[model samples]
Target: MTETPNLKIPHGGYVVVGDGRRALVLRNEGHALHLALRVQHVFEAPPNPPTREQGTDRPPRVRQGEHRSAIEQTDWHTIAEERFADEVAAALDRIADAIPALIVVAPPRTLASLRQALSERLKRVVIAEIDKDLTKLSIEEIGRRLTDG
Candidate 1:
């Protein structure tokens, strides 16, 4: 009879945990995980302008009594988050070949953004994805959570 391979065993690979604000890159070392890098999004926080800026100039009114309106102001927070995701994706792309596998952990929205930002090649290496913000967790706690879950 053929034996089935054990699926519960964790493979050596990279573990990435983050939100839009910060990220942690960890690699499996023997049976333990070690931090390889930390990435922080300096622009994740919204800028503090001296005062609220005025909206874009209104569209010129037509002579026929109707007028077009400008689009709503940009959502800077969402933009920053997406930019952060792109940064993470680029970082992953650079190291994808070095890692045997990959596990991603992030908040739901950030995870979606990161998934969208990753290249198709990088996407193939992802072994698991946990939708939780673990960027703030300690290395030990993160390791435990990864193993327990």
Candidate 2:
């Protein structure tokens, strides 16, 4: 990893940290990093669907008498993560010009979703990607992680 100059913000760059449920956008000011944005969007899926009282309802068989089960469906949690990633991508796109460099910190799953959601334009400015869930870390800890090689 190329050592950053005291981990200062590259002009108007940003560092983003998130998981499936929450995200924190930060920017470096002088020698400190501060919260530049905060998204508290949460996806609360019901414990059970109206049709089923346990887990998600499985799709009905294609044929009434067919022995094969319906194709497995995507989980609500996965869908929510994708949607959150899209939201993050859109937010980054909106501030593309202001942020020339970006450091993304998220879990492996969320990182994958974010990678898929990012547009080509936004991809160009991504400087580093840390595959770890840092959403719960304090600001000082986050700064240390960003600067630590």
Candidate 3:
């Protein structure tokens, strides 16, 4: 009797999406080809505040006790952006460590930004950009697209 080849693909990497509140970690290699609602992580975005002039007429000051908390609650948008990028970058880094090739299909803008932020080593990997929101799609549909491609 012939044995069936264990075409099991290893964990390719994690897929980080959403506004950091919702993300997916696709471990198994064929996961992207087999996941329906690809959400595995949900985290609150970090807090960031805008920078003020270094030497202002009146230097900014805050009570010691309130300083920490106050500073933490400033620019939410910047905080979210940084945190999201950091999380995604970390996931992609792990993926790069595992394989010689990786195909990243995200919105064109996101793909461009991520491509620029990747390390030199990661840049060596095969990165493809596709404008599709995979979070809403099913594994079967994704598989069909892959096979068709």
Candidate with the greatest TM-score versus the true structure: 2
lDDT of 2 by residue, 55-80 (tens): 45665556556565686655666776
Question: Whole-model Cα lDDT per candidate?
Answer: 0.67, 0.68, 0.46
lDDT of 3: 0.46
Backbone clash pairs for candidate 2 read none
* Tens digits of per-residue lDDT for model 3, 9-75: 2245433333333334333345543533243444444444444422233444558764632223354
Residue 42 error, candidate 3, Å: 7.5
The best candidate in terms of lDDT: 2
Query: Which stretches in model 2 have alpha-carbon errors above 4 Å?
Result: 1-11, 31-56, 63-67
- Write down the TM-score of every candidate: 0.70, 0.73, 0.48
lDDT of 3 at 121: 82
TM-score of 3: 0.48
The regions of model 3 sitting more than 4 angstroms off are 1-22, 25-79
What lDDT does candidate 3 reach at residue 39?
36
